[model samples]
Target: MLLTAIAPMTAEAAGEPFDDEAFLFEPKWDGGRLLLHKQGERCEIYTRSGRIVTEKLPELREALADLPVRSVLLDGEGIVLRGGRPVFDDWAYRLRISQAAKIRTARQTHPVVFAAFDVLCTDRPHLEEPLTQRKARLGELLQRGGGILTPTVSVEAQGRRLYELTAAQELEGIVAKRKTSLYIPGRRSSDWIKIKHPRLIDTVILGCRSEPFELVVGLQFRTVKNKPVGRVSKGLTVEDRDRFLQAARELRVRQEGGVQWIEPRLCCRISYRDRSEMHQLEDTEFLAFLWDKQPEECVWPYT
Candidate 1:
């Protein structure tokens, strides 16, 4: 069946397979995946899971109004530029807008750029073709693009090199793909892989909660070893938070200030970009929480 929803694959390989093999790779964007449908006089935006986001972005709808194709389904991400840098948080604001004033505020203050990467459907059906061919056709279809369409490239080695550089430069990571692999929807096959950033650090779990939320473990850590650190709340998703809450009854610890002290045995590795004031604030708004330091798991890139 033709794939719709996309699943990101983890990168376990440190280097490419030694063979001069078949693969095409591109920079794994930090933004979310957006599937667009421009059919005749109608336009709709869908997530990989088929969640419609048509009304969320008026600016995007207006920008693509000039496209030639009456009907087109394209895959891409909405990115925002802040301080001359493309910030994922700026794009995320568009997703979080719930009021007209908020939407207008986003449009006027935080503009978005639709970076189209693939053409799922054109006036002519092209979804059945191999990814290599479809990607080429996508390039041809979006030819009249300015900087709005950030086309993906199919350079495996170059992608790997870029991945290495991104690690050094503290950028996110890259996604690599087998040139011949079919586009499998919501499947994380060997065809696609991600090499994420590698930077590890140990942190202390100061406290955890049970009622306020689930497995929400509050953390406090010193940037430098042996230095006094402030409270840095993080380390749990909504789902995990619930689970942790249930589990907290069996794993209680002493409370200190806003922190709950737990066994400092579960230090996680994390990754993050160099502290940019804009991206930091942007990330906080995107995550709905302030992030003082990168996650511990980010340091140990190899899971």
Candidate 2:
């Protein structure tokens, strides 16, 4: 039961992928990290932040409870698949359902699966064991789960190949984990590195939202024309936020419906996974302010 509350281990970001015989590469699923604790017939699922989410995934809970092991603690992702690929938006939607009836209905219509990547405990703890051993144990323990529960597939010494496969499939990315590394709960360690397929774009700051502090960014066209792409706030540090707000004070043009319009003089770099059908940026994260670049230089085509 204590393992259920344990913070999951985190991975650092790697700029690029490399071939390493000592590393095991696995798909970086775009879903929420979850810990599953099952003892006897009792099963509970917890998010990475330690919030209990068992009520939101009844089908997954039941499937995990039926595992052949006596008691097991699993580290994995909670994903909702569409066309055999994990969709974070759908998985996120499932997490937001609170009403009991709605959750039950969603479980039937929009089911989520637990893709177990690591095994922390089986009858006893195995945190100090090396990752290669833990992975072998994980595969053995998850041999008989239904479709609702599955093991994450991985390749040894083929990080580049796996990364290429993920890119071709348009998956999130690949995780390169050292085979000899031990799981360190709650720590972001270099032993496990995540290589994501993110695209970078430079955009002009069009405005700012007062509440929750988000920057409205757009791609510059002609000197006077702009096309709004999306809003970004994810990667801003406190200092960066303060600096932007201070700069905005002098550039304020007008306030329209809770948004403070600026003079579109500042430019910032953004990292995102892709663009939506409507051309809005998806999974947008603010990288940094482009001081050397002009707003007019952040133009359309993003090249």
Candidate 3:
């Protein structure tokens, strides 16, 4: 319903970080990925799938309304910065809250900021232009210290160093992309790579999901206290999926959305933002399939 569903450029996963003068690095913010659309006085924010979340995030909507342009589409993230960190759980809770009074209270307590990174359009399309040109234009359109919309910080030819810094701060990760790359919607282009933190943790693959396609992963963490952490659908190559499916039939546990639940016997290492809260891990990635270690060995601080 808005701006022809602006598709943000997607990034491929890289095994490790590297340095190249051709590529620029940006700190990957841990929050909801949003494509904010604003036209005249009407503003709407949508997820990658194009679901309208304008009503859900009133503060972001207000910020967009304050933009200097009459019509624009921006690719960025919506984060609730708490103690200098993006607390995603709080953003998720705010998205579902129904009471007006509660929503107002949360807005005052934890305000949302739109971290604009790319400009898809400003009354006209900029998709044909290279990323470097687009980024400069975006900076001109969005003023610093002027609204909730702050442009994401970028570094040149220092992806590895930036990755190390992000890991040190326990931030999500860093994304590197070619300056000459054009915005290719709905495609994971090689020009862009998402390099995850170096930290790794072992978890068990409990099942296979097929509807939207996911790997049901779990861990016996002390914080979660011996429970299934959550599902991990990204970071598995085609070869990994093929091999996993080969041994899946025999380990079936149950079914939901074509998800072949299996016995928790498979263990693997993965990279993610951080630990689980209450009962699940967020933004998970499958790194490898463990063969030498037992599944119980994948327990939290498991030995």
TM-score of 1: 0.63
Task: State model 2's lDDT.
Answer: 0.86
Error of 2 at 286 (Å): 8.8
Writing each residue's lDDT as its tens digit, candidate 1 over 1-303 gives 122333322333433322225766666555667776776777666765576666787766765555677777777766676664456656666787869888888887887777675676776766557778878878876776555655765565466577666556544566676666665445557666665554333333334534443122223323332222222234446765454345445556677654455543333322232222122211110122223444343221111
lDDT of 3 by residue, 179-267 (tens): 99988778889999988675578888888777556787777655553366777878888788888888676888788666687887777
- Any idea what lDDT model 1 has? 0.54
Give one digit per residue, the lDDT tens place, for model 2 in 213-279: 8899988654446678899989988898899988878999999988899998899999986565345
Which lDDT values do the candidates have, in the order given?
A: 0.54, 0.86, 0.79
For model 2 the local lDDT of residue 201 reads 88
Q: What's the alpha carbon RMSD for model 1?
A: 10.1
Candidate 1 minimal-lDDT segment of 10 residues: 277-286
Worst 10 residues of 2 by lDDT: 273-282
Query: Which regions of candidate 1 are displaced past 4 Å?
Result: 1-21, 199-204, 207-303
Query: How well does each candidate superpose onto the true structure, as a TM-score?
Result: 0.63, 0.74, 0.72
